[model samples]
Target: MSYEDAFAAMAAGTDEAVANALELFPSEIQTISIDGADHLLITPQNLDPGLANHLLIHVHGGAHVFFSPETALNSSLAAAHAVGARILSVRYPLAWKAKFPASRDRVVAVYRHLLQDYPANQLAFYGGSAGGGLILSSLQHLLAEGTDMPAAALLLSPWVDVSGTGDSYAVMSGHDPVIDYPVSLASAAREYAGTLPLTNPGPSPIYGPIESGLPRILLTSGTRDLFLSDVARLQRRLIDAKIPVELIIYEGMWHVFQTSTGLPESSTAWRDFARFLRTAWAID
Candidate 1:
């Protein structure tokens, strides 16, 4: 099916469909409290008995308003097996209760706690869409405070600019069947950001400074995604800063196409992500 068609199928409650689709994978789903809020965690059922030297922390996407770790189980499990790493899918605060720095701070707290037990060089951050924006924003916060960055990062169709200035916003609008464009997304961003300026790097990473010494970054986006311009702008900034950056732009695909695990495009996206993780973690 085409990306648009797949997204339509997904928008019609595909989470339930994907959950059933992923039953074959050996995995566990549960919740853990981070900063007094319940957050979800998904790990493989029989993760290699050995303590994983590497960990993958995933933040979920819902325009900063909806969904949680449970909705992303299929791709999360696939990534765990492909990379030979443990996965921690965080349940950060949503836009309704908290706002801007609240969600970002929650993830940072979890990362900080993880660092106490794992080496900084062995932990990587992964997220898609709004989650991708959070990963980058969180890194910027850590860097500003002189904390160590992750070993690597994987961003899939990141929504890096809430200001909505990206050129693709118009080009990919109706073409992207998943998101409805500036109408819903912009309104949600406004609610999540509260009084904070959308241009603030803490809220929108694309406008933030590209710090040196960050971990290797692998960004994935579809040519048809509304945030295509955001990804492109981020790529240019990171490349200019001499950061190790790799971008995979899928032709004719829409936003977060990989969310539909049953589709062929979704499989390809996951494989590429797995390969990126394997290499990043030095997994043989």
Candidate 2:
């Protein structure tokens, strides 16, 4: 099934159709509310509550229009496993229903709430695709409001350039297994942007300022991923701005390919991801 088809299935409430199309993970899922939005706490069954200090706030990817905390439970668990951290996965308001800044606002609010329970330096953000872009957007909002930033972030093939101006969008067209550009990606960006221009830095994030005081970020993208160029662009911008950043380009993987747990490359990526988190958290 195409990414667009899966999204439509999800939106149409065709549970079995979408469920059969995706791989899921086993996690202890808990439903919670923050700032009037649904949020999920998904943890490894053996997760220790004492490690709450090392929190991973995940933003599930769905092109900003598909999936929910429930639909994305397994993917969120994969991240929790990769980082070895308890997760507070944000089920932020989706686009097509609520537009630009709605998801951003709710994420920031949840981040603030999480901050009250854990120190800013102990928190981390992880997201793939649109969720990855939202990671940057939420940080931009927090920074603009003078709120404390988290310790670090991980962007899995982040769709940072909502305008779809990246070269990979064209260059890697047929090579990419997921994400059909111009049509699939651009349409989703429009739905999410609503009345806002796609170039609006607050919503697009790639157009946002990259400077000091933002959290250190680790970004991963496959060479075949359509968002590779956007991830590369943001990495360079971060480095140019003198912010700490790391970019890992998988030789021939597709967008967020680490979710394909059966692949040996996926295992390697997860190991690297875990190591990155440990280094960022200053954990041995």
Best by TM-score: 2
TM-score quality measure for candidate 1: 0.90
What is the Å distance of residue 249 in model 1 from its true position?
A: 0.8
Clashing pairs in 1: none
lDDT of 2 at 101: 88
lDDT by residue (4-113, candidate 2, tens digit) is 67766776663543353233444666778889877888767546454657888889898898887766654676667666678888878878778988899889889999
**TM-score quality measure for candidate 2:** 0.91
lDDT of 1 at 92: 83
TM-score of each: 0.90, 0.91
Stretches off by above 4 angstroms in model 1 are: 1-15, 45-51
